[model samples]
Target: MTELPDTRLFDTVLVANRGEIACRVIRTLRARGIRSVAVYSEADAGARHVREADQALCIGPAAAAESYLNIAAVIGAARASDAQAVHPGYGFLSENLEFAKALEAAGITFIGPNIEALNVMGDKIRSKNHVAAAGVPVVPGISEPGLTDADLIAAAADIGYPLLIKPSAGGGGKGMHSVFAAEELPATLATARRVAAASFGDDTLFLERLVANPRHIEVQILGDTFGNVIHLGERECSLQRRHQKVIEEAPSPLLSGLDDGGAVRARIGAAACAAAASVNYTGAGTVEFLVSDDTPDEFFFMEMNTRLQVEHPVTEMVARVRGKSLDLVEWQLRIAAGEKIDFTQQDVTLEGHAVEARVYAESPAEGFLPATGTVVVLEESVAQRPGVRVDSSLARRLKITANYDPMLAKVIAWGTDRREALDRLDAALADYVVLGVPTNVEYLRLLVADPDVQAGRLDTNMIERKLPDMAFRTVDAGDYAAAALAARKVDVARPNAPGEAPAASSWGRLDGWRLGDPAPWRSAWAAPGRTGVVTVSGPQADSGTEGPGVVHVNGIGGDQESRTALDLNGTTGGELLWDGQERGYRVGMLGETVFLGSGGWSVALERLDREAATARMLAGLEREDAAADPQLRSPMPGTVTVVNAKTGDRVAAGDVLLAVEAMKMEHQITATMAGTVHIGVAVGALVKADQVVATVEPDEDNSTTIPEGE
Candidate 1:
């Protein structure tokens, strides 16, 4: 660990990130009596991070580029708030070397790795060279710049048939391509280059020898100015998709060699420690390695992440087990202020096993398509059982947008051993409920229960290979059944229905039926792709007692046994079974019609003439049809940012029509098509919800052509 000057650090520090990381940092800072400041964009003004900070500043617009990634704005906010230090929490500008330098120039302490260390580690080629020169085993590959196709081909051939073409400046799996055959080189390289340019602003790439069936292991290292560096064991980040890790755990099951106490684990940890010391690295960083399961001796350098990783909580758990609190943010701040590590490597200890699963707002069934919507109901296990931890920033009624990463939260579980940890993790996931948006929770649950995962035989390709059916598995049948049952109960207990029975039978009827006062019932019904409303009513009664209800479909009374009977005069409604189980229903009036609760269905009474009723139904259908069309305009004012199709373009059903950029994030407008595009709105234009963004001309000969422009 490096040593630092003996001086007190800043009184206040500003956190320049959002979500759970920001909240986590603020809690630590407050506990230490260090004032914490926060910065938020427009969309995050009401976010948890903003509310938790001691003080907060509105940086800029909601787009990450305009706010979180706006280096200038962040520096200005730090200056205005009089914060002596700036903490870039995990993402955003955390690993950005230039941002660190800018803070230095402004005389504000940056709570992370120094600029020199960041510059070295930020560039993959430079970091690899430094690590290799330090006698650390590096992956066999070519890092030299400017290689032609022939040169790359020869290098690939030399490294063996299967190799990885990774962008020198890439992380998060973008611009990463694996090739097992020579013929796939050119196309893969092109894609890698394009992805690299888009993600990292650099097209420089390198080739690395690929290890077959390798576990992704990384060691957490901490260094201070005093030249003291210690390794805090390793984390297993083997569960990945498109090179992005979805789940991580500490004290790797693979490292323990199936819990048999293997010699390979100690050697790998030592090698990781050596890699960190080689670069003279200081502050919190991770040295990642790829370990082949088939051959223990075949471990090689993968990459080095220069900042605290997204999965840092697992490492924190390990530290807790050692009876010591390790604050990565504090370590960086103290080191930058000239503090040396107070403890030696042998002083650190590893404890219980911890597992972390990233909960993302993405649709696994839709090829992991990122989703955005209001989180109407976000529920987790109410009881925090032993060895369980949930790190999240989600709350009920929060909106998820497409402007940033889709990760909603990270759920971690800790136990004395791996099995216990795995068990806890599975339970936590099973109890989590996130409604109003698509998520991959169900998919993760399935993965954790897999035989390979349970056995700890993990690799980067584990999810892809073993859970091939995961993308199509949306809901667990048991969970769906439970939700359905709950929904039914809610509908039945509603008080709006006159004929609906109360849960308690204490209230007795005051009189016999002349006719029960008419009451309306509103109930909703939902299936896989269909939803509808059904309403029923009980007749007027002078005795104040409601009789069995009569069902009405669009105001027309059903010719059955009063549709379904309700025990209004008794405790608990008579079992009203639909599909299965006795569910309750409540009723209310909407205009002249009645709505049935317990099922969210509505019906209207046909008091008008037959001709008038038919006319009304047609009008209602037109309105419903218009509302269901996806080619409509935005409900609020916004700018058009994405135009997916043009005139004469052929489109399939459910293809995106365009995107509206409102409040900084983009909202895609999709096409409900079985035809060709006849008209569409241009990009950079303003739109409203019913405003037609595009018109589709059906392929059938009777198709009508809409106007060129709205």
Candidate 2:
């Protein structure tokens, strides 16, 4: 066991980050009795992390570069807060050498690797060269960051088709693109360069051979200043979308062959340690690898993240000794305080299997496009649940802006084995709910139950191959009828028998009025996306929103009609006895949307007036069509960085016309048809979601099909 090398523990610590990661570190600091300081941008003034920290400071405005990524601003905040050390979370300056050096110059501690270690591992090209010199295998490719685009094109020819263009400065799947042909290199290259520059402040790029149908495995590395280093086991991160990890699991299933103590795990573990020790790494870091299923014993280095990873929970769960997982952030603090690791490799042992699913605010049906809205209601929590944990940044009424990453939270579950863990994870995901924004929750629910995932047959290409078959569950005709019934039942106050005349409006309301037999109180409602009519008739007097009443519901689209007894207690839940089973759901009214939430499903119903709904729908259709016409709107909110095409400039389809940036990632705007361009927004101007940035007047003479701009 290594002893304490020095005694200089920080009394106050500042976390130079935001969101769930900052909250996570604050929790550790609280446990250690260390004063916690948090910094936030204007966009996150009242965010959860700010409220949780012991002290809060405003760094800058909304944009990340002006706030979190501003080294000077972060250091200034640290100094103002009187923090002795600063912990940079997974992203945003976590691996920045300049930030560490600045802290060092100011006599402040940066809780990561040393400057030389960061300089070596932070650069993908340099790290590859350094680790390869220590007898570690790397993906074969050209990695010269100084190469020109033409030179890169030449390099691609020798490397052959089906390679990847990657930024040399950062990972986390940002600015990484796969090329399938020689002709696609230039456009993909330009995109990678722009994204890399915007994301990592470095546009230098390189070419790496793409490993097809490979499993993503990463080892956790920890070291101290006394030259003692050890490695935790590997985590499986093969489930990915657009090169970003979506779901991760510990104890890769491929290592099942080596469960009886084979050399495979030991070999990979030693390699990761060697890679870390080569640069004298300190604190927590992760070394990612891509291993082929055909030869699980052989693997190639992908990249090493020089900071704590987003998937650290799974590793922590597997590495837990007692009821609590090891305080990795505490270890980070100790190492930063010049303390050495107190335990050897033999002290660490595997406990149980754990799986983590990253939940993002996106619509899977729309190609997983990011979405933003206020969270009306949130019921996700893992506090009371056993073997389940949720790390999130969500609060009721919290508006999710399009200014940062789309990831909302992570749900994790641990069990005695893989099946139990996955099953628990599925139930936990279903238990999680969010309203007022489109999310991939339902899509994730379906994914955990997939046959291949259940059988542990996973690869980086799993989601891409099964995407066409996946869909988001929507409310059906029955749900609409139930919604209409519930709506009318709760709105009536005066009682009228089944054959009595309909009640007139007490005040100035014209809703819930009818003039026919069997008409007690009639109302019409419509589902959001479906064009149909649903009507409900109920007893007039359902006092206090609950009474014994016979309700008749009908839907015109499917000719669905039903008569049943319903107890509508305003927002309180009722039961529906249908098709041999009784289903219970809680009914809540949110403006026009009616939410029927239950165990495993939630359906939203939009209240509609027959006349107004029809007119407004027609108007909405007109507005949508006009919005999609010649006007080219920005898909997301961002600042316009460059406008390439001018008014009256004739351009072919797919020509880059403008570029907008958000969260430091640049998005290019292209012409949909061969046409003359009419630019709307100028460079350096700020634009909101769906704001018109340009217009493309389609050239009638061209015969080639025009693709729509995203």
Candidate 3:
């Protein structure tokens, strides 16, 4: 064990991260009255963390390698800001042992486990061996560093056919593969090796017996310099996609077991505490376990996270119920300064259930591929119910980039019981809004509403088996209607600068005006799956209004008797009335064109510019034609896998140009127009869908005779 420093160290700390985690740490630092500094990349200059911190500095470019992950730059920022410590918020350098050592060398506090602890746990195989030696029941597997093909096959037989081939030094589900049968062993092992090499620079492999439909339960463990350690209960993290957790809830239903009196719960919690004690772990850490519901009496160790988890909010909620703030960030800072745990393990108590859903900017239908774009719209409803909370780091104009994890925000809801907590979560998800880039909001809705999920019968494969349809349902018509209507309203009321046209009259005038004729009125329209349209009609009244006159849509048909004092007012300003209900509509006129708003869709009532409209119409038609023609284009957006043709090579219509892979699925691009090959894009070049990969120059002068189909 390492020696502890004196208490009350570090005046100011710099957070070397972006987005919600940065904001989260800053909030805690302020509560402790510690001066906090925030560092940002070029892309995150105007981010929420930059605004929230007491001081902010620009580190480097947007790419993580140069900005967030650049140890020198981060250390330089810390020195420049006179910061006494650096807090790595989760990703980037959070788990980097070298970064921790660098901070120590600089005489700065690293607010996490010491470098030795990180080095040990950083390697999965090594960590597993240590924990197994400490009496924790790890999954049945080989702990060898490297594995040959023969070794893998032999290990698979020992662990049984359905085994997990995982990188010995990997996390977040990357560099991991599950093999169901013996025939798939070679290919799965190869893929796992490649991913491991690319991601962690460690192609070392380990085989573990696959736990079928296992619940991912992790115990929150915190230790201090004095050897005091405790488990803050367990979190159920079974809802996942692409091996990344989507939803997390604390006080797992599995912990309750089928029997009462907390007998099994106590046993599991004791084991978790023992696991942490074995590591001599200090500060905030988590011990993950893969629990099989079929074998309720037994559970095996999965891994140990040496830092604060991404889903730490659930633990925070549990801590709040005990009338004490967990304050993980503050604790880490103090621990780095050598503060011991003052309270005993009995002080910690697991309270109400809290659930968190990670909102990511990605296309769920496209294998959850990360998406990057400006957030055009973002809204989350305020929590009106008690015991509910929300955590987010997005605004209306926040930009999501591809340099880091795709997670945009995390929505956490808490309640006195599991059912109420779930209800609050469902409501919050419904009210949550994010536009521009595709999100998994609707997919989350499906998961929350799932019967298995509600009944707490969740597992790692819950999403894969339960919601196969979710991968294809990209367009939610209701969401489209809401976005469209909101956009239209914004456009109509927008102010014009000098020399711009004035606002038009709210209502239109009709030609017929008689003593027995009906009065005019306006009507607001709304359709869930379609565009909204507004209609106006009534007797003509020649009152001088700024723009158009009001016409009653209800009185379009001539009724002999007057009903409900219906009267037409051509000069009436403000908003228009549709059958007594007021609909907010703004009409404007520019030159001879009159603009009318019907939700997001609008209509311009003026003589159309024949030439300009024709040009636009033709352009649209040509674009559509190009999109529909697949004969001379790339199949999908990806890097070119191979180049099969040369500039002067003669190629047939069915010849292959190159292959592309998107989200790990391969697609082949083929030649459709037969002629001399003119290769444009080369191998290893990036291309988008429908982009011209290669062009075939048609042979002239009967050099190439037309085929029968041609």
Top TM-score: which candidate number?
2
Give the candidate number with the greatest lDDT: 2
The TM-score of candidate 3 is 0.76
Worst 10 residues of 2 by lDDT: 540-549
- lDDT tens per residue, model 3, 85-188: 88888878988988999999999888888676798788888888888887888899887776786798877887796888888875889867888999999888
Off by over 4 Å in 1: 1-8, 148-154, 258-262, 320-325, 380-383, 471-528, 532-710
Every candidate's lDDT: 0.68, 0.78, 0.67
lDDT of 1 at 586: 33
Reference-based lDDT, residue 682, model 3 = 80
Evaluated against the true structure, the overall lDDT of model 3 is: 0.67
Off by over 4 Å in 3: 1-9, 320-325, 365-367, 381-385, 470-492, 496-710
Candidate 1 minimal-lDDT segment of 10 residues: 597-606
Candidate 2: lDDT over CA atoms?
A: 0.78
| Residue-pair clashes per candidate | 54, 1, 11
Model 2 clash count equals 1
Q: Mind giving the per-residue lDDT tens digits that candidate 2 earns over 652-694?
A: 7778899887643467788767778899989889889789888
User: Residue 575 in candidate 3 has what lDDT?
Assistant: 45
